[model samples]
Target: RLIQRAKRFWPAFVVAGLANALFGLLDAGFVMLLEPLVSKGLVGRDPETLARAPVFVIVIVALRGVAAFVSGYTMAWIGQKVVAEFRCQVFSKLLRLPAEFFDRESSGNLLAKITYNADKIARTSSSALTILLRESAFLISGLIYMLYTNWRLTLFFFISFPAIAAVVRVATRRFKKASHNMQDAMGTMTALGSESLQGYQTIRIFGAEAQAEENFKKTVERFRRKFMSMIATQNLSTPLIQLLAATGLALVLYVSLSELQSGRLTEGEFIAMVSLMMASLRPLKQLSSVNSQLSEGLVAAQSLFDILDEPEERDSGTVDLPTLSGEVVMENVTYCYGENSPALIDVSFSVKPGQLVAIVGPSGAGKSTLLNLLMRFYHPTKGRILLDGHDLESLTLSCIRRNMSLVSQTVTLFNDTIRNNVCFGLKEVPSDEKIIEVLKQAHAWHFVKELPGQLDAMVGEGGSNLSGGQRQRLAIARALLHNTPILLLDEATSALDTESERHIQAALDALMTDRTTFVVAHRLSTIQHADMILVLEGGRLVEQGTHQSLLAKGGVYSRLYRLQFGEPQLGTTTS
Candidate 1:
């Protein structure tokens, strides 16, 4: 995937590789120049050689510097661009992924993949590749020079090559394993830190600071241990490889010195050979170090690819309804999470246009599950849902969602101006007048007006600057601004005090006046005026009627209402 993304920058990479090769050639040329400068200028006392050599050396050095800069800059550019594209693809995939995927994965791990892993990939794709190529060129050119000067000595110098290869191969396997473990450990550390930071208030209120700190410390320690192992492998391999090179150097020196005493090798040739051998050692050491970085990059790339390959949410519906008539019906719908028992069992209900329907049930009685199915966050395990007399499966998901607005107990707000949060995702930006009107209708304009910049004030992360009731009211205002034909509320006012709830409820009454609204609330009194109410127990719909009618029937709804309101006297009317 990285290579595919880098296609547009291939020319740049090619130029970089050629430039690096040229740099290596210059290195070798410097070694070759030493022989002529020493023999002709110093030993032979040639004035012409002395005068020309300095200019030749200066020109070669200047060209090499330019090549080095171009090679480094181009490789860095390609690496950054490739990783940027990869990160974008990952983020886009996250947006398209099904809700179930998120349910099983941690946000911190996903974040690490986008940030930490991407940087590792950049190092591998650019810096590691540059070092590998440049060093390989240097080593190859140095060897060719050695062979030209003295093949017998060059052949002896390669005796340690096989042993060095064996050591590197073993070290490569260890480095890869360590890299994988470190990546996993880092993800765990990120998850621990994210959880603690996000829930710091809860920790403080509950006096669980020590527990949180301990958990975070454990995760960090694990990451540190893994990181140290990786460092050890990386540090050990370089010196070990260098030691093998040193052995080869010692043998070459021993042979060259003998040849020098026998008059078979000139002083200039001997020095040139030694200088080339020493120059090659640095590149050899760098190549060994790069193996660890390459391993880290490969591990990160694999993790990112796993996310990119995940299947996106299925959207098979072809019909695109321009508008919905606000009628909703569920027929024998059943759903189960995984292999667990069904969350909703043979449940069914219907609402006509402009009707107010309330769903009241105990925890785990499928109140929220019903809403999820309606929103198409999950498909029914059996039967189907219909909107405006058409199966919901027949209409595009976007069309179905666009016609409905949701206000839940937990509201999400970005760190942006209040206006943007209220008008979030709208095709056309809402005017100031329209924004204020919705806020007024939702009973939020009073507080919003008192804020520093009114509608333009920043809300801070997750609307942390606002009180819970204020945030809830802002969410309702957002929903009202959507002006969808259907409204779904999941305990929209449950988190507020009685006074706040009453004020917000009044605004909701107006908002629901002309829309089909489905509400799930635990507060029995809140739904007494609903046009129709459905009572659920243990995933089954036990009763359906107007609140007064259900009370007259003396079924599950009556028992629940009696429990909340206290048992009615035998002679007194339940209502």
Candidate 2:
């Protein structure tokens, strides 16, 4: 996948590498010229050659400098594009993932893949690989020149090969292991930091600031330790490589001295061979350390690819539904998250096209799960759900959702103007007059009109600048504008005062007049007027009836109602 993506930039990548290679070739080629220059220009004092020596030196340096500049600049540009493309892939994959994936993975860890892990690929593509390619080329070219100068002497250069390989093998393993640990710690740190920042107000109110700080410090410490481990491996390998190179040089020196005494090697030739040997050793040292960067990048790439490889939410249904009639039915529908116990069990019910159904339950009784199922966020583990007599799975997911509107307890608003937030996800936005009419219908236009920019007012991050009631009203305005046949209201009125709630409820009642509305009610009083109330307890539908009938039956619904309203006992003493 990486190769396929990078193929578009193949010309630039190759040019960058060729620039580096030219520098390496020139570097080795210069050492080869040292012998002839010293022998003819200096020793024999050849006039023309001596006079042009300065020009030759300048030209060689200039070419190498130009090559280095082009290689560095071009590689950097390619690195930016690579990072950008990978981040885009990660983000696009996220949009297609199933709700279950979000249930298991935190937003922070996912963001780390884009912000932290993707950068390692950039460093690998530009810098780490740069050293790997350039240094290898330099080492190969230098070795070739030495062999040409004195084949017998160059053979001794291999005396330390086995030792050098051993050091590199050990260091590579250490680097890879340490880098993996560091990345894991980095992800944890990012998750913890995001969690802390988002809930800082709650943490402070509960006097848990010290606890939060300690937890953050621990993650940061773990990240530091892992980073140090990678650094230690890199630091330790350098001296070991230098010592091996020196051993090889000592053996080569001994062979060279013998060859010189036997009159087989000239002084100029001997000097050139030693110069190439030193030049070769520097690149060899750089090559050894470059593995650390490569190992780190390898670990990051694997993490990113793991996300890319995950199958998107199953959309096997070929049905492309048009507008729905809002009729809904569930026949023994059950849902379980992974291997856990079912959150909804054998839940069977049916609602008319324009009926208001209230789902009342304790905190974990799967009240929200019903809405989640209707929204096709998850499919039933068993049984089936039907919309307008068509299987839920048969209808396209987007088409099924288009017929519904949701306003949850926590209203979601982007950092955009009021107009955009109200008309979000609509391919073609409604006109300003239409938006204003909807806002008034939601009882939100009063305050919206008072804002400086009115319709163009920025909501700030997650609508933080607005009060909870104002945010909820805006959400209602959005739902009102959508005019979906099915409306799901999950405690949307909780943030408002009694007067505001009454007004919003009146507007909502008008809106739900001919719509299939499901209210996941927290307050029994609010849903008392629902046509049918489904009372749930421990993931089972224990009772179903209207408020007056359920209260008369004296079941779970009656018990919950008496508890909330503190209904006076028929015959009992006060505390």
Candidate 3:
């Protein structure tokens, strides 16, 4: 991981190293100028080229300054490129991930991994790589100059280096652990915010605003504490390194002064060595700081790699059904949401082309689960679902869903113009007239045309700006515009009032004319004319027939019908 990350900025690292080395060499050369300035030149005794010595040093310094400027900008550009590539890769991975992966992971937390964590990895990796390369190069060049000037004094400085390494190692391990905790807390905070925002209406309706705020505050506080702790752990390394540097400098200065006094070291040589020692400040500081930054980067890289490494969606051996007749069949399917609680068991049914089928049952009777399986949102645990004459598992998901349209209970609208929402499922740009035609057919045109901007008004997020019935009607209009052969309606009319339901049901009746339709309906009256009315109880198909045929038999469907529309004391089922 480290090597690959470094390679991402290889060009920058290489350029920074060369530039830093040139600066270090010039630093040593400038110190050599100090010798002449103090001795022969400082006395103002020469009238020759010695008068121009300071000008030569100034030119060298300017060149070194320009090199440093180029190095910094080059590294910054590399960092931005690396982050951009990482974000794009994560987005591509999201498209390839299986649908079940989204069910198990929160969208907000996954978004953080793609955006937040990728940036952290890029910033830390690039900064650390830049620091490591430039400083290591400067430190090496500075040390070579020091040794050539006086190897004995340089050797004295190395004695305290082991202590520096030991302190940095301990600090970095804590930093990495704390950083991981901080990132986990961030994901939790994001999840809380996302869930709350999505369900803001429910929170307000229940008057649990305070409770939701308190819950969000708790997550924010936990994340704050974790982040502060990580920052403290990283900060500890700086002071520890400073202590090591102070101790090392004291020893080196004492030994060098004694050498100078004994005539073993020239005055010019002693000053040069001291200058080189001062140059160690940035490199030595960076040597300690790099470990902590690199640890944080590794923590982020581990998170990013964890996401990228997940198993992607497979299209193996899957072929298109050419064209579907919209005959759906579920054969003895068993499905469980968890290991212990079954959602559906041994459920079987079939719907022929252009038939209208209504699946009615009590809540939690696998009504939605059956639709979910047909949509391939979750694969069944046992048996198979067939589209046309081919098994659903044998066809590509895109191929199967292309022939189907779904208008669900919970309507979703993008913050876009009404025309786009109505034609969302089309692979190509749809004609404006076609969208308006469907809107008229769905009985949505009356309100839409009255709006200030017909078909062009922006629907707020999830259509929150529209009334419930209006949103439902728009959803129906969208389905009608798609014009697929199959339609799945899951409580699509539950939000509508009696008058609105009557108006929209007529439109739905027209839309379902020659389409194979499956309706998960709670109001039995709406589905009385279905070609097949299946009564589901406890995940089993209890009764199956047209409404009139089931009423004649006087079974579960008859009991439910009487319970819904009959007098309480009539005992209609027993009669």
Candidate 4:
């Protein structure tokens, strides 16, 4: 895939490479010409020619330098363009992926691919590609010049080229191995940083700050060691190539001198031959070095492709129902987070419009699981869920989500102004009056208006600037802004204090006026007014009825109510 993607920039790359080759050929011609001019003017005592050699060499060097510069700059520009396009494509794919993909992967790992792995390709494209073009062109031009000078000597030097290639091949393997370790270590460090920041409150509450820091430091140190090791391996390729070049240069001079002394070659031709041989070997050695870096670059490219090739959301594209009535039916739904470990079992329920139903369960019961199913984060192992009598799978996932609003136990907000967080999903810019009304309905407007910047006040990362109750209010406000007919509240008030819960409950009471709501409640008192209360245990619905009827029956619901809210009154049958 990377190769196919890279082909998009091939035209520019080829042009830049050819420019570099032409420059190398010009440089070699000028250098070879010098040998003759030097021999004719100095050895043969031609003073006029000797004076002109310096001037001619200067002009050739300047022109060739300009060509090399243009070639390098153009290649870098092409590389940047290709990398930009590649990154944009990757980001687009990420956004288009289904919610289930996020459940199975870490945000930190994917983030490393985007920020670090993509940067690696960019660096490789700019510098490694420039080296590849310049060295390849120099090597080719140098080889042609050497063969033209003396085929016999060129063959002798060429014999060692394979040996240098072997050394480079071995060294590059080590560099690639080290590069993998380095990238993995860097990912580990990134994960640790992300975890620490995301769980800062947990670490602080548990007084594990020191341990967290130490863990983070360990990952950083491992990354440092791995990258330094890769650098060491990459650097060794250069000196190793130079050693081979020096050995070959020594052999060539010895053989050429012997040939000249035997009258098999003229002094001027031998001088030119020696100059051409140096030019060829020099570039070949540089190319050997570049070969190692480029090989490591391919390793990074492979890592990038590993992410880009991930399976995306599999939509059949058969139907795209945009709106849904507030009616949901769950028929014999069975689900498990892992194989053989049930989370929901043969669960069946129905919610009609304007009905407030609460799902009450123990800690391990499948209250949240039911909500996840309705949202299509995970499909059921058996049975189906229908929205307004239409199968959820038959409709586009985005279309289903647009008509529903979910307020989970944990509130998620970005580091943005208060108004933006409240009006998150509105494609068109929402009027300030609408945002203010929603905030007021969610009981968030009073405190928000009290703040210095009011609606424009910046919420810190994940709304860190707000209190827990304030954050929950903001999240409720977000749901109100969405104004979907179907509302899923999964322990939305479970984490709040009593006062905050009361405040939020009042807000929720107002918001639930006409919506079909599914409430996952842990606190029994919260669901006393619910039209229907279903009790779950071991992934199965044990008892379901109105709070008063369940109390009369004296079943599991009554048992839970007594345990949580203390014993209930007699004759309080179905409200």
Candidate 5:
């Protein structure tokens, strides 16, 4: 299958193969030069021919050198091409895979496929291929020369053939098994390393460094064991096969000596024959070593192919969704994660355009899952959701998502300038003046302007250089710039201080005036003025009504509010 795929680059493969073969054939032809030098030049006293031998040797060596260069350079080029192409395919597949797929798989494993496994393919394409083609040519040429010199003696050399074949067959299976184990171990090691680095602060705080170190050491030891196992197999088999072939060479040499004693072979033929056979041993040993590279490449290829074969997210919708008025409706919706109990069950709700619907719930009460459904990240397992009276499933995923902007609790900022982070994924990128106005609206421009580079300052990875409040404010700024019809804020202001939260709430109030907004909040103070609040508990809507009304009822929302504020001051809507 890999070779068939490589046929796409047939021109390069052909050039590299032919050059490698010519190099080996030239080497074999070089050995035959000795026959003439011994018989014709020395014995026959051909002074004229002997005089030109240096030039002949120089020309053959020069052509062989050129062939080696062309072969090595071109094969390396093909290897690089293979790595680039496979990485691109894997990367594209990652972008299209469903969110559930990402949730279940570790990121480190995916990364290894693109980096380490793809590199194995390169080694196979270049060095492994070079050895296979070039050595076979050299070995075949030597075998032919041996036959021409003394067919009877060459017949004895074939006695060790089955043993060499059997050894290679056993070694190949072991090599492949070791390669698979090594690749999987490498992925686990990568995952462990990434986790330790990313969670370094927590590790230090908890003083669990020893535990982390112990776990990493175990994984490293596993990887090393598999590596050494492969090496031991390769080393043991190479010499054993060499010894077997040497036995055949010994048998052939004994026969040749007897033939020489009987005057059946010339002195020049014997010398040329010995040199070619000795030369043949080198390529044969190298060929045995090629199995390791080929095995690794094969295992890596299967790993990459598995990723490529996974089905992409199902996007069967074709209908166009017009600019939404943000009226969202869910009827008997149910969702479950894998085989677990449904997160949201038979839930139904409707909110008109421009309504600030706050979904308040306990930790596992499925508040975030509601927002996830709204964003079309995961389809409801058993029910339908509609936006502006249009069934969400009938609309393209892009169309459904384009009308909403999300600011989740965990902010994600790129390692780029603040301006780029603020305007991320906006179809119509706002100008500097507009961006500043949006940042000012979200109350983030104050800190941004005080920074060294202001709007152009680098955020660093995940906005690590910024404070938690500043990151939240920047995310709000980005959502404001998005300027979509429907806004989803999952604890968007959770990181802000009381004073900062007040300021951001004022900004959000202004931004939410004409758009439909959903706020999933635990802070009862923030949602006091929400036009309608849906109180969810145990994945069911236990209560739903205006904030003042729900508070007056003294139900779940009322209890939650009193728990935070210590009392429900119902008449005045104050944060």
Candidate 6:
């Protein structure tokens, strides 16, 4: 996959590889020049050759510098582009993944993939590639030069090469294992840090600072140990390889010196051979370290590829409804989450084009799950939902959601101006007058006007700067502005005070005059006037009737209503 992504940047990598090879070739030329300069200038006392030698060295150095610049710059550019593309692909995939995927994964791990793993891939593509290409080229070139000078000594030097290769082979496996561990540890640390930061207030309020600190320290310690293990393997391989190379160099020197004394090899040739042999050592050492870098990058790439390969939310529907009449029907629907037990079972209901339907249930009664199915965040495991007489599965997900607006208890507001949050994703940006009108209708205009910047005032992350009621009102205002034919209110007024709830409810009443509305609330008072009431318990619709009729029946709804609002029986009589 990495290679597939890199195809577009192949030209840059090819240019970099050629330039790096030129750098290696220049090293061989420098080594060859060193012999004549030393012999002719120092021993034979040739002044003209010595003077020209400096100019020759200067030209080689200048060309090598140019080659180095091109290699470095081009590789870095390719690395950055690769990192950017990987990040974009990962983020886009995250957005398209099924809701179940998020339910089973952590946001922090996803974030680490984007920030940490992507960077590791960049380093591998850039610096690692540079070293692998340049050093391997330099090593091969140096070997050729040494062979030209004297093949016998070059053969002796290569005797230790197999030992170095064995060391690298053994360490490569350890490096990959340690690198994978370290990446997982990094994700754990990021998750811990994210939780601590987001819940700082909870930590302080509960006086669990010590516990939070200990947990974080433990996470960091694990990460540190894994990181050290990776470093240990990488560092150990280099010196061991270098030691073997040094032993080979010593053996080669022992043989070469005897050849020199016997007059079989010229002093210039012997010196040149030694220079080229030594030149190979630096590249050899770099190549040893490059293995670990490449391993780390491969591990990161594998982690990211796993996410990218996950199947996206199934969207096979080809029908697009430009508008919906707001009528909704569910026919014997059943749904489950993963291998867990069913969430909704054989449930059935219907809503007229503009009727208000209230779904009241206790916690864990599938209220939110039902809303999720309606929004097509998840498909029903069995049966089907129909919108305006068309099967929801046959309609495009966007088309299904386009006619609906949702206001839940937990309102999502980005850290941006109130105007932008209210008008978010509107086909045409609404006029200031239109924005204020919706705010007024939702009873949010009063507080918004009191702010220093009015509609332009910035809301902190998740609208933290706003009070609960204020945030709820802003959410209601947003839904109002959407002006869709369907409205989903999941405890929308749960955050508001009685007075605020009354005002917002009035606004909602006017807004629902021509739109289908679904209200999921545990607060019975708010939905008492709903056009139809569906009572649920343990994933079953236990009761369905008007508020007054259910109260008269004295069934599950009556008992629940009595529990919340009916008069308490006297205990004194029994005493």
> Candidate 6, residues 210-310: lDDT per residue as tens digits?
99999999999999999999899988898898889988898989998888898878888888888777777788889988999999999999999999999
Off by over 4 Å in 2: 569-575
In order of listing, the candidates' clash counts read 0, 0, 0, 0, 0, 0
lDDT by residue (236-258, candidate 2, tens digit) is 89878888888888888888898
Query: What is the alpha-carbon RMSD of candidate 3 to the true structure?
Result: 3.1
Instruction: Report clash pairs, candidate 5.
Output: none
lDDT of 2: 0.90
For residue 356, model 6's alpha carbon misses the true position, in angstroms, by 0.8
- TM-scores of the candidates are 0.95, 0.97, 0.90, 0.91, 0.95, 0.96
Q: Which residue pairs does candidate 1 place in steric collision?
A: none
Candidate 3 CA-lDDT value: 0.81
Put down candidate 1 lDDT per residue, 457-554, tens digits, no spaces: 99999999999888988898889999999999999997788987888889888888879999999999898999999888999998998999998898
* Top TM-score model: 2
Model-by-model lDDT, in order? 0.89, 0.90, 0.81, 0.80, 0.91, 0.90
Compute the lDDT of residue 573 as modeled in candidate 5.
70
Question: Could you tell me the TM-score of candidate 3?
Answer: 0.90
lDDT of 5 by residue, 411-474 (tens): 9999999999999997677789999999999888889999998999999999999999999999
Q: Per-residue lDDT of 1-575 in model 3, one digit per residue for the tens?
A: 54574585677777866776666566556766665565455555565547688688789889879867776677677777777777787789888887778878988888778777777877675677667766776677778877887889888877778988888778877888887988888888888998999898999999999999999999999989988887786677777777777677778899988888888777767776776677676677876677767777788878878878888876552777656778989899988875757678888888999999999989888899888888887788999998887888889977877888999998988999898889886878688888888888888898999877988998898887789899999999999988889999999999888987888899899988888999999899899999998788887778899999998887888888887986442343553
What lDDT tens digits, residue by residue, belong to model 4 across residues 1-575?
55677787787777787777778777677767856685788679888888888888888888788888888788778767867887787888888776667877788877887778777787677777676666666667667767776777778776667777788888878878887888788777887899899888899999999999899889989999988887777677767777787677778787887778887767777777767666665676567656656765677678767657877776543556666668888899999765668889998888887899999988888888888888887788899988888887887877877888988889999999998898888787689998898888777888999987999999999888998878988888898889898899987886678877787789899889888899998788888999888889999988888999998898788878876865554545544
> Global lDDT for candidate 5?
0.91
